[model samples]
Target chain A: MVEKKGLSYWLSHAGLILGVIVIGFPIWLAFVASTVTQSEIVSPPMPLLPGGEFITNYKEALFSGINAPVALMLLNSTIMALGIALGKIFISLLSAFAIVYFRFPGRQLFFWMIFLTLMLPIEVRIVPSYGVVAQFGMLNSYSGLIFPLIASATATFLFRQFFLTIPNELTEAARVDGAGPVRFFFDIILPMSKTNIAALFVILFIYGWNQFLWPLLITTDPSMNTIVMGIKQMFPSGDDNANWPVIMATSLLAMVPPVLIVIFMQKFFVRGLIESEK
Target chain B: MRRTVIFKGWKLPILLLLPQLTITALFFFYPAGQAIWESLFIPDPFGLKSQFVGTGNFEFLLSDRYYRNSFRTTAVFSISVTFLSMGIALYLAVLADRLIKGAGIYSSLLIWPYAVAPAIAGVLWLFMFNTRVGVVSWYIGLLGYDWNHVLNQGEAMGLVVLASSWGRISYNFLFFLAGLQAIPKSVIEAAAIDGAKFWRRFRTIVIPLLSPITFFLLVVNIVYAFFETFGVIHTITSGGPQQATTTLVYKVFSDGFVGQDLGSSAAQSVILLFVVGLLTVIQFKFIERKVHY
Candidate 1:
């Protein structure tokens, strides 16, 4: 029995090691491809280690005059991401507080309506949504990009779930001390649910930063484009002479923010998931 | 007293709902309604002449071989991607759950793919699969299978699916890993005491308990497969190889934006909306009930 158990454990360990390799290979390849020259990448048996052309490749990618500067694109993506994150978090907190703390008429109906939007995939609405943005004269503007995505259903839902788990006694005590609804929310509720807010912040920031489709449709001008769009523009459609080293470098540049965000907030992200389940 | 209390209670919700309502109305509702209206009319490119076609666009779409092919391709794309990625993600999640060390390293590395923007990810994959310079192509040549995603429909579809799944697995893996960890250890211990084999214990106990997470992941994955693949598909394939890779959303973008057939594009959008809406409702009605939670 002991021998059989040891054998099974060894098999599971082997399976896990193989699974990790499969998952990790693409990421390793991405890093390797970023460092090597375009020619080295396509050669027979592909280079297995990092090459010395990293600086040249990066400079070529950054200075490719075909589109907006990489620095400007990164700045644009950061501004857009921060704007959307702030809007989503603020709206979500207020709404979630109202839903949880107040005994509102038709509250259930409103909640369900928002929840329904959660299931409505953006694909179904892209064409009409584009028309709406165009009609409002928001097509090329940052406001156009930020406004539509600000009131995130997922953030609101997650916040509501978090708020519900908070003890009503705390809020009641604050109310007893003559605190208004706004005061109670700002002072007590928001502070207590800081972890949840942080978690949602990270998630929404990543989503906004990585957004591509709507940004692609709305912004035709290179200056207004986000990093994701900037990356797409780097490799012009069907151009055989497109610089691979530059493409790889530009792609690696685009990856920096989200990767940093993930690494920094991972602990909170996991905690947020665990808390939401509760 | 009751009326006053009700009014007081309702004010907060009303206030909170205002921003969401405005955004949804303008961005979600109005556009959706406009698309439906536009689908019924034929409008010229300059937005000048307009004539009511009244389901003519639908008829055209229904009969068109290209639209028919897109529908077939979309089904194949969504189903295969969702199942393939979900299966792999679940397997990895379960294995990760059992391990006591290096879990964070594995999780972080696996999720790095998720951090890569879809456009960038597509570009990276495109490089790796390039005919002359691609690592995948070099290996494929070595293996004796002439493969070029740009020229072959099946190859294009495969690349899209592979890329799409690569982007998705990280997010799905997180949810599945959390779900696995949430399952009570006591139940497993009891099963072990009853002399149940590993496969039997997992099949009868863990699988059933993980249904809620599985169902949520399935719905989310389906939605992603439907909409989120557009960017990558556009970047990598542009619905190419004779429109072999064009899913419904890709078709909508092309028809409306590129082809300048606003009415047909609107019609296609409405069809997509209906399909997604139906699936969503079915998911809630049927799958939600099956969830253990």
Candidate 2:
């Protein structure tokens, strides 16, 4: 019995080790590919460790005008991401507060309408959305990119869920003390839901930074392109002999912001996922 | 007094919903409605003049060989990827849950891929799969297979599936892990005390309890596989190798953006929306009811 139990334990441990390797190998390969020169990557026996072309690859990637300059693209991505994050958080907070703290006609109907949008994938509306942005004369502009993404049904849903869990007595007390709805929400509700807000902020920031298709279709001018579009433009379609080193380098640069955000806000990120489950 | 109080209460709700409503109307509903309207009219790209054809676009799509293949490709890809990734994720989540140490490290490491955007992830995969410089190509050649995703349809589909699954597994793992943690320890302990084996305990207790999360993840994973793969497909394959990898969304983007067939693209969009909406309603109605919570 002891031997059988020991065997099962070892089997489970071995399976886990294998699983980790399977998950980790691709990421390791990505990093390795980024470091190596093009020839080393395609060599008969692929280089198992970092190669020597890191700096040269990165410099070429940064300076290449395949898209906008890499630095400018990064800057555009940052502004767009920050704008959308702030806009989404503020809008969601207000929407959640009204729904939770106030009683009004058609409230349920309005809430459901917004909730249903969460089910509507952006792909279905890409063409018409492109037309709308074009019609508004906001094409190739940051406002066009940011405005469409600012109203997030998922953020509102998350905030509403979090707000519903806050004690109503505090808001009632504020109201009795002659506090207006805005004042009550700002002073009481927002403070109580800080964790949820932080989590949503990080999530939305990542989403906005990583956005590709809509921005690609809507923004015609390379100057307004985000990091994602820049990375894509690095390797022109049907170019068999495209520079792999530069492509990898640009991809690495595009990956920087989200990786930093995730690593820095790792605590809030995990908390957000765990809390959302509840 | 009642009327005055009611009016005052409404002011807050109205203010809160105003920005969201306006944005949604302008960006989402208006565009969607326009797309639906455009689907009924064929347009000349050079002239930008549209003429109403009334179901002509839909009829053309229904009869088109390319459209039929794209529909099949999307259905097969979404279903296959969702099941494969979700199945593996559940297994990994169960394994990780049973670990006595380094659970946090395991969890965080598993989630690393999710941090990268789909476009970035596609580039990373493309870097590793390029016929000239790709490490995977080197390995494939070593194994005696002439594998170029660019030229081969089957390889292209496989690469897309592989990339999508690799990117998606982390989310499923996270959700499943959460669901596993939610199951009460005492119930598992009781089952153990009753001499129930691991498989039995999992089948009778854990599976039933985690069904809701599983179902939620299923719906989400399906939706993602259908819509979210556009970036990856566009980047890696560009719906190439004789249009073998062109899923429905890719077709929409190509037809509308590249082919400049806005009317047909809009018709396709309406069909996709209807199909997804119907599926979602059916899923919720049937599967959600079976959920314990």
Candidate 3:
């Protein structure tokens, strides 16, 4: 019933185009606001298109922000995000390897313990977790930002599931080759898990970069602020004026790294999301 | 699903498991237990000692008008966000699936918003609807609707929910699209040959096939609305206009951190823990059912 230039074809295209526009409109508006001057944005009906103040607003935001330089915040966010992603991947790989490949006491107990973490997201235990972190003198440091967040049950479980699918013959062959567990993991399992690790990295990096309440609660120091949480700090309290252009610029900057990662690494990202949830 | 061949070592395995276990105990179990513990007592104003109150904090929370209002607000906000985001995502996914070509381009464009942090989404939405300078509000004013989220409670709730749902649309869209693509073409062809129209075939066949993904998204979006919308509420309204937009998570934050009511906050956390536990159980059970299918 369908023709080359049919009503259904045109209608589907029209609907899809509308969906794309609606989805992209907010980002587009934010981009325009970032490019315009403060006065232009403060007045009603801010310019819908980009303005001449792009470099000025961005430079100001990067060099001297309301509390701390946006550059420093970006650095802090980068450090935290990378730290969490790598730390989680490293630990999850080790634990999953241990659980799957080795016979050990409390294996089931440890597995169950990790699974229990899935229910207790940081949001649920935020207050006491803050207490625990503070009691350890970790507040406002990179470790405070990174350590508590890196205990990822999801990542560990994903790796554990992957490890189970590995054929038994491979491990048997490795042992027959006089290779011990360490050598086998390094030479075989590690190399094979490269794609999964890369995929998980994409997912975890976004997770780390997007962390809000945790970073907000722990990092009281302006210099320790992540770009994501740092944007909120720029808001003017009470009657003071807000520099909308710079604040918008900061928002744009906060989105750039993760957005780029998602766009460029769409394959790995989609795989990581769907598979991890599964 | 244990592996057949295995390594025979206790030391190395323990070593490998050490870091994950230690972090989990310190961060996950310890704080969770502490939340349960602290929920049972009222701390002194000086923060030195806590008096055992049993369920006093929970009683206080249940009787508190503001706390009850927060519970209602969270219910409404999350339900709105879940339906709005999922509905739009499903529509887009259906259209994209109908296309034989260029679906990838639309999918790519739509999905990047998933990468935008929820707080940033809030800031962007706030800018667009800022009472004085927001472009959208200015247009709404042109249409003679006073659009001040600053002063209006409902508008504040709407704005935060919209912002929260904006980023989530991408996530739901991806899953729905994948679900749609996985349905067999032969099934649809068979239905069409039986004289079923597009809508009829869709209702009778496609939607049933897609139910698993839909159910999964429901739980995920609800969980997201509960916990992840904290950043949105904090940035957009600070749960403001007289706490009209405060979700339970937001209440815990404001009470525990800002109000310094640790006992009440801890009690709220315990309630939330149970809520999460219930949702997790449902999700795992549903997953087990799906595996059988």
Q: Over the stretch A40-143, how does candidate 1's per-residue lDDT look in tens digits?
A: 76455668688888887777666653587777777889888998888888877777767776786788987776666664555566777777788889988998
What is the lDDT of every predicted structure here?
0.77, 0.79, 0.92
Cα RMSD (Å) per model?
Answer: 3.3, 3.2, 1.3
Cα lDDT of model 3 by residue, B156-206, tens digit: 999998999999999999999999999988888888888898899889998
Best by TM-score: 3
Q: After superposition, how far is residue A205 of candidate 3 from its true place, in Å?
A: 0.3
Q: lDDT value for candidate 1?
A: 0.77
True contacts kept of each: 0.55, 0.57, 0.86
The clash count for each model shown is 1, 0, 0
Interface RMSD of 1: 3.9
TM-score of chain A of each: 0.87, 0.88, 0.97
Best candidate per DockQ, number?
3
lDDT of 2 by residue, A130-152 (tens): 88888999998989999888754
DockQ of each: 0.49, 0.51, 0.78
Q: Which stretches of candidate 1 lie over 4 Å from their true place?
A: A1-5, A42-45, A63-65, A100-116, A271-278, B1-16, B286-292
Question: Which runs in model 3 stand beyond 4 Å of their true positions?
Answer: A1-4
